[model samples]
Target: MKIGLYFGTFNPVHVGHVILANHMLHHTALDEIWMVVTPHNPHKKKHTLLDNHHRLEMVYKATEEYDHIHPSDIEFKLTQPNYTINTLVHLSEKFPQHEFAIMMGEDNLRSFHKWKNYEMILQDYDVFVYPRIAENQEEVILKSHPKVHLIQAPIVDISSTLIRKSIQDKKSVQHLLAPKVWSYIDLMNFYQ
Candidate 1:
């Protein structure tokens, strides 16, 4: 099986994420796109993030209807400051039959070099990159990388930060999130 790992904090799963994952499954050679819910991102502030369990639950709620795209909690059991290379190595060993590739936005490609064991990641696994609203770093980094694939996807101008702000302001976010996920968030009084 070929899987595209779309790793993120998914602070709260939104429509943009769902659309991108769907696009990857249909447009790419991937059999499935796993929304890997990172428990903690070393680069991000922990105070602003929702609990790992809540974020993972929201991911599951948001992606439950899409059979081709599933939510993963693989990072929950791993140590803090989880690195992509470490996760990839572990996934490869546990699921040797599956071919895994990293799925990310072009914006992330801009800072790819700053990641731990970045060279090893590029050498060992394929990177499937989708475009962002104003992304310009892809060409710079992928100019000579054979394993990096640039995928053209619609750029949705939405972010978890915006969603959280909307919720705090008591604004409607019906179009931003899945119905179930939105209901769950409201029921649990998250990001309020």
Candidate 2:
């Protein structure tokens, strides 16, 4: 089985995320996509993040109906300041039966070289990149790394930051997230 690993903080799972996962499943050769909910992303600001447990619950709520899209808390058991290379290495050892590929946005590809043992990651695993509107610089970077493949998933302009701000401002996030996820956020008072 070939699996695509889509890692994110998912402060609150949104529609854009669901759409992207669906797009990847339908368009790519991947059999399933595991939405790996990271506890802390080294590249992101910690102050803006929700608790990992809460974030994981939201992802679970959002993806519960879809068998192909799974919410994973695999990074929670791993060390903090989670790095992709270490996670990939651990996953490879534990799930040797499945072929794993890294799913990421073009924006992340631009900074791929800065990641820990990035060259080893590129050589050992396939990276699937979805285009981001603001990160056109990824093209230049991908030119240097032949292992990276550009995927034409629908670009989602929505981001977790925007959703958090909306909740903080007491604005409606009706369509931004799944109904269950929105209810969970409301129940927990997340981002408020």
Candidate 3:
């Protein structure tokens, strides 16, 4: 089976995330979309993120109804300062029957070269890249690599940051988040 690993912190799982994920899963040859809940992304500040369990639960609520989309806490068990290469190798070893491909945004692809053992990652697995409305992006060689697939999934402008801020500011987020997720956040008073 071919799996597309969609990694994110998911501070609060929003509609844009589900839309893009569903589109990718259905449109591509992938058998499943695993929404990997990143414990602590090296690129992001640790303090700004919600508790790992909270983030994971939100992901569960966001993806519970979908048959193909799954919430993964694989990264939470791995060693800290985890790199993508390490997780890839671990997943391959743990689930030898399945093949894993990275599902990332174009924004991350721009800095793929700077990741730990990026050359090896490119050599080993396919990368499914989605569109993101980003600014000041510079051209990079990896963007044109044969292993990299530029999927035309809908461009998602919504972000976890935007949801967090909106909630903190007492703004309505009825449509931004799944109803269950919003209820969880509201009941817990997260990000406010």
Task: Flag clash pairs in model 1.
Answer: none
Error of 3 at 19 (Å): 0.9
**lDDT tens digits, residue span 129-175, model 3:** 99887785678569889889999988878988988999989999878
* lDDT at residue 16 of model 1 (Cα atoms): 96
Instruction: Return the lDDT, model 2, position 148.
Output: 84
Q: Write the per-residue lDDT of candidate 2 for residues 42-88, one digit (tens) a residue.
A: 87788878888888888889988998999988999998987898989
Q: Which candidate number would show the highest lDDT if scored against the true structure?
A: 3
- Candidate topping TM-score: 3
Cα RMSD to native, each candidate?
1.4, 1.5, 0.8
Please provide, for model 1 over 1-192, each residue's C-alpha lDDT reduced to its tens digit, 9 standing for 90 to 100.
999999999989899999999999999999999999998899889998999889989989998888888888888878888899999999999899999999998888878888899899999999999988764534556535888899888887889999999999999997899999899899999989
| Per-model TM-score on C-alpha atoms | 0.96, 0.94, 0.98
Sorted by lDDT (best first), the order is 3, 1, 2
